[model samples]
Target: MRYSPVLDRLAGLGGAKWELHVRARERIAAGEDVVDLTIGNPDVPAPADLVEAAVAAMRAGRTQYSDGRGEHNLRESLAARYAARLGRPVHPNQVLCFPGTQTALYAVLMGIAEPGCEILVGDPMYATYEGVIAASGARVVPVPLRAENGFRLSAQDLAERIGPRTRAILLNTPHNPTGAVLTAGDIDAIGRLAVEHDLWIISDEVYEELVFDGVTFVSPLARTGFADRVVVVASISKSHAAPGFRSGWCVGSREFADRLLALSETMLFGNQPFIADMTAQAVSRPSEAARGMRARFAARARYLADLLTQQTALGVHRPEAGMFALVDVRSSGLSDRDFALGLLDAGVAVMPGSAFGETLGGWVRVALTVDDDRFRTASGRMVAHSLSLSGQRAEA
Candidate 1:
C-alpha cells in the first residue's frame, strides 16, 4: 500500500513542540521538577456548574452518538449564543458541532479546499494549521505577520498574496503565539477582500473571549455581507479551560452548515453526547465564568511581561490578548531552539518559535497555563538563563 505525498510531507514535519511537551511531562513524572511552558492547555479549572452538568448528563445516559451536525439542543443553544454575541441573528440549522476546534478546522479544509487550492495563513501561525492544510493537499501560502507590527494582518500585504487558486483564508484572531486580536478595521478590510476575491473565510475565534487591556476581538465574518462565505470554528477549550471536554462548534449559512454536516458524517460520525450537554450549559451561562478565566490569563500575562522586561536580552511584546506571550530572544546569542533547550536543561520548558515556522526563529513562546506562583518562578528562571546566555555571547 502507498500513502499520498501530502500525507508523507505532513508526517515529516514532526510535531516537535508536542514531542518536547511529552518529554517534559515524563521528566516531571520522574521527579525532575520541570516547569512546563510549552503547550497552551489552560491550567484554569472548569466551572463548577459545567462539571455538574456533565456528571448529570452521563447519569442520564446521554453518552451515545449524537446528530452528526450536533445534538439539536446544543446546536440551537450555541447558535443562539453566537447570535447574541455577534449581534447577528442566525438559525439553529446554521450550526454544526464537532469534537473540538481542531476537528472543526480539519473538516472545514476538507469540505472547502480542493486538492490543488491555496490557503493564506499567518507565517508564525498556530502549527496545527500547517498539517491540516497539508493533509488536504492545498498549498498553505505564508502571510508574514511580524511582532514589530503587533502581528496585525495588513490588507495590502494579503491582497498581493491571494490569487485565482486561493480558495480560503484562515484567520486565527486573538492569535496563538502573539495573542494579537484583529481590530474592527482589520476585519472590515478582510471582509472587503473576501467579497471581491470570492474566497471562503475560516475564522478561528477560539480565543475570542480571552482579550485583555481593552482589546476587542473582531471576527472577519461578523461584518455585513460576508456571513455566506464565512465559517466560524470556535470551542470551549481556551475560554472555558475545558479542552478535555473536546466539545466545539462551527457556524455559517445553512448551505455551509449542511456541507460541514456531510463532511462530519464521512469524517467524524458525530460528537459525544455527554460533552455536548456540558458545553450547552457552558454556552448558555457564558458571562461571569468566562470573564473570571480571562482575568486570570491577563494577570499571568502581566506578570510574565514584567519579568521579561527585567532581562534586557529578551524583548517581549506582551500579548494584548490570549494566553501565550512571544518573547523575542534574538538579542541573546543562542537561536530560539538552543535557548529553549538550554532552559529545558535548566529544568524549565519553553517552546521555540520555530515550532510556529522558520520565520519566527528569533523568539521563544511561553504559556501562561501554570498558576501565578509557578509562572513567577518560571519567568525568573527564564530571565536568569537569558542574561547568562547574553554574557557568554558577549565574552565570545
Candidate 2:
C-alpha cells in the first residue's frame, strides 16, 4: 500500500525522548526497577471537585455533543479568566475550545500557515510542534536559544530570521525542556517584531500556571498592539492534573476563533460535553488546587536542581518556571542520545535534549512530575554515572 508523500515529512517526529520513554516503560513492565523522568505525565491526582463535577455532568446527561465551537458556559468561563489575567476585555466570541492543546495548536497553524510558508520557532521547543508544523504543510525555522543567554529568545533573533515567506511565530512561555519564562519586556519586544512583520503569533502558554520562584507569566495577548494578532493556546492538563480529560483552549481575535472553530468542526464533530463541563468547573471556580500543585512542583524542581548541581559535573539550571530543568551533559563526553541511553541502563530515564532541537545536543531535560523519593534516587544514579565518566576521562 502507498501513503501520501506529505506523510514523509513526519519522519523523525517523536525523536529520542519518546523512544526512551517507550523503552523504559517496556523494561518496567518486564520487572526492571526504573525511575522514569522522560515524560511530563503528572503523578498527582486531579482535584476531587473536578472529578465530582465530571460525574455530575455525566449524570445530568451532558454526554451529547456540544456546539462545534464549544459549550457556551466553558468558553465564557475561560474568556473571563483570561480577561482578568490580561487586564483586558476578552469576549467568548474570541475563544475556541478543543479536546487538547496539541490539537488546538495544530488548528491554529493550519488556519494561519500556507504551504511552503515558514513558522519561526525557538530552539529547544516542544517536540510535538515540529511534527504538527510539518503536517500543516509549513516549514519550521528554528532560532537558537543559547544557554549563555539563559535560553531566552531575543527580539533581535526573531528579527534576523523573519523573511518574506514567514507567516507565523510560535512562542512557548515557561518553555518546555528549558523552563525559561519570557518576561513582560521580552514579550513586548517580540510583539513589536511580529506586528512589524505582519506575522501571526501562536503563543503556547500551557505552563502559564506552573511558574516557580515568584515569576509572573506574561501572555503575548497582554502586549499593547499584538492582541489582535496573537492566538494563545493553553490547557488544563498541566494546571489541573487532568491530562485524561484532554481539555484545552485557544484565545484570539473573533475571526481567528471562528476560523479555528470551523476547522475543528471538520476535524472533530465537537469535544466531549461532560469533559467541557468539568473543565468549566475547574477554570471558573476559585480553588487552591493549582497553587498547591505549583508549590509542590517548585519544591521538587529545587530539590533535583540542587542534587544535580552539588553531586554531578553536569551543568544544571534551576528553572524559573515550568516543571522541567535542562542539564548540560557535555562533560560526560557523550552525545545527548548516548547519555540518555546510559542513564536508562543505570535504571533511570530522562529526555535527551537533542530531541527538542539540533542545537541542544549536549543537554538532557529532567521532569519534576515524579515523587520526591523516586526523583532523588534517579538523581543519585545520574550523579554516580557522571562521576564514573569523569574518572574514566581522568585515567585516559
Query: What stretches of model 2 exceed 4 Å from their correct place?
Result: 15-17
Q: What's every prediction's RMSD, in angstroms?
A: 1.7, 1.4
- Per-residue CA lDDT of candidate 1, range 1-396, in tens? 998687685885656656667778899999997899898877767778888989999999998877877888898798788788779788898988888899889888888987889999887889788889988889899898876678877787789999989998899898888888888888888888988999988999998887885787777667767878999999998888788888888888898887677778887777888888888878886545558757877888788777778656578777877788888888876788888888887778988898887768888888887888888888888888877877887798
Prediction 1 TM-score vs. true = 0.95
User: Which 10 residues in a row give candidate 1 its minimum summed lDDT?
Assistant: 285-294
TM-score of each predicted structure versus truth? 0.95, 0.97
lDDT digits (tens) for residues 150-192 of candidate 2? 8888889889999999999999998988988888888899989
Which portions of model 1 miss their true places by more than 4 Å?
A: 4-6, 287-289
Best by TM-score: 2
Quickly count the clashes in candidate 1. 0
In candidate 2, where is summed lDDT lowest over 10 consecutive residues?
285-294
